[model samples]
Target: MLPSKTSVTDRSWRAGTAPGALPLLGHVPALWRRPLEFLASLPAHGDLVEVRLGPARAYLAAHPELVRHVLLNPRLFDKGGVFDKARQLLGNSLSVSRGEEHRFQRRLIQPAFHPTRIAAYTTAVAADTRTVTDAWRAGETRDIGDAMHSLLMRVAARTLFSTGLDEATVEEARQCLRTVSHGIYKRTVAPLGIMEKLPTPANRAYDHANARLRQIVADMIAVRRRSDEDHGDLLSTLLRAEHPETGQKLDDGQLLDQVVTFLVAGSETTASTLAFVFHLMGRLPEVEKRVHAEVDAALGGRTPVHEDLPALPYIRNVITETLRLYPPSWMAMRVAAEDVELGGRKVPAGTMILYSPYALHHNPDLFPDPEIFDADRWAGERAAQVPRGALLPFGAGSHKCIGDVLALTETALIVATVAARWRLRPEPGSALRPEPKATLEPGPLPMVLERR
Candidate 1:
């Protein structure tokens, strides 16, 4: 039973545990089937709603204030939950590292995202966008999800390696990523992890894909080591980077971890966001016309590079709203390092904590008519009114995503480039569903490409 609505506002209100728990599975069924809806429904119960994950009970921070406490205080609630599960794939990369070690990991990787380096990477982004557009026909319908993933994988490979490996290997790596991503979420929810070990098709695919990707990367690393020339790409930066405090370069294992992290993360997240952006543009014709108009005035069919970002504020805001509505990195989880208090509630040590940017962004109290897509809100005084910590597509505090600038730049450029030549019209026959995997992917989005 839930507490009264008035009691929920009271300072002493304890969060209600979510109803409909099966004996062994708990809330896993709800999460497995309808995670986005499940996350969005919690705020009505309380700011700190308790829910079960398999056998373990986790607290979902339903309010932005509670979320800020968890994200800002990294020491008190360090990275865990899904990130800890990520360690099986990415070793000690910044994704899962904590405390001093996490700080050191950031030091090693931060240099690649410097202003000049990012500008150079934008050249690759522009070139890759053309590669995708050049192949599209005027009236062809596209599987936008797969197309965006393919385009982003190419962009990620070029920016990360600058064509160090053969095209075949890059394509193979991209396919492997799809398999690995499919298996990670199932592993995260299953308690005790015995089911994952069984010879299931999904399990086999994940294991094989993981091994093949590692081998491909190891081979690339060895080949790059044999050469002395600097490629000026992300791989070269990491290969040459020395720790600020220790003056030590990362070992091969550490490099592999970081490379895999960037390859998967760099491509997966932005691709999903762009896919959503195009789908939205298709659904909202008025929005599509404005974006196309902006692109023409800004670029005149020329490819959009990183420096052109300022000229395209509307495209950026479209991406921003897309992120708000369908944040790919939907669920951010942490474990309480010790006993702590959040939102006037006592939280015990070792509690697994969860926060959803998707939920907070959709809160009607925070943003009125939250379901509607509005880019103009981010343009004028309305944008200024957005509460701090309310928009967390890239997260916050010390552990915020390092490639945020690059992600935004790439998304805006792709949208601009696509709009310059064509307008995406969502295929009306298909009913799109949000498949909650490693990212919140728009499953099977077939869009007809209408040449503007």
Candidate 2:
């Protein structure tokens, strides 16, 4: 049996099942190799399509309504066993915590991402961005994706622990995060496979990456703990942050998890989106021109600050549209705690559910010519018409990404800063594709840097 719904349960068999599944692996190959096409194909199968991960049956909530349902009803579709791989690295951080625990942690960490904090963090954002892109030479090729990742890593380090975020720490964090991002998705799809236990090269690297990532966070916490002087950064906020009712502060382990949560959650999605923004601008010169004009008008030869964000509407729209086209956090998982009905069909208890912002954003009915990179779709009037859960670049509802504002602020500032300096032209003879790693990353984006 393929575990393709036909062999699992009658409810799964009755639902439209995604085809081309293997006996044991089921949809893992499809998901691993051609994730975008695989996800996009599910809507055609049915609004709620059944697929498999290893031997376990799962449902793909292809419609935004079902996705909204899953996202909103946290208790019903919580981050339980469905996200074991992610949980391994995330470690019950706010990103993965459920119930009252999640709420309590969110209360502690929310202040660090407050609008005021976001504005304060822009200095680090602008500086770190320039540091990464400054070394670019005219007519030279560079992996913008790698650069953005490194940039975001540095930005996070500076913002998280301004006191001791040296080059070594930033470099280690960047490398370890990339390793985890590269390996996490693979582990998720092959949950039941014995490859996880074997001492294979991939397994070794994955294990090493996980340990290194935890250590990276631990080192950051140690550095921050040693510095009694207030650094006025995210680490300081988190250190002092107390619960509203109980007035409780996070313990050492809790604080460590929170730090890892920010680094893991904030870095890749924002970085990849920024990288894609540059790549898209490369492909769409007209869009690039408007961004340039906007950046020029707002930040004439000066670095973009927090206040400059309001003046850079087109830049923001470009980022938003890029997000719509390639939301890095494309697929999100939820496991049904109890039996539930979804899309007028029965979804059995403990059934793992998946939703993709990539699929929904590409739904033509929602946004016509969904594949095209049209920033105007999110422009003033048109932006209003988008459904509430339709644009889930950072997800929606209670478990929505808390760093959404911070990430958006970083994107807008980086867009303004980079657009002001150079035009990144796509490399010749390169086959561009989104690799579904930690996020839907445009892997190895070799772009030609042209000085403005």
Please give, for residues 348-429, the per-residue lDDT of candidate 2 as tens digits: 8988899998888888867888888889988778888886567888888788888889888888888888889998888888
Structure candidate 1, residue pairs in collision: none
| Highest lDDT against the true fold, candidate | 1
Q: What ranges in model 1 sit over 4 Å off?
A: 1-26, 53-56
Q: Model 2, stretches more than 4 Å misplaced?
A: 1-29, 52-56, 200-202, 206-209
Top candidate by TM-score: 1
Tens digits of lDDT, candidate 1, 1-452: 32333333355644777878888899989987888888888877787888887788888988776677678779988886566777875787877788898888898778878877887776878777888788899889999998899888888888888877676887899999877766666676555778889998878888999899988888878888898788888888888999887898988898888888777777788999999999998888899889988888988878887778899989988999999999999887889988877656677888889899988988887778989999987988999898767889999877898989878877887888878888888887876687877788888999998877
lDDT (C-alpha, whole model) for all candidates: 0.83, 0.81
Error of 2 at 392 (Å): 1.0
lDDT value, candidate 2, whole model: 0.81
Which TM-score value belongs to model 2?
0.90
**Could you tell me how far off, in angstroms, the CA of residue 274 lies in candidate 2 after the best superposition?**
1.2
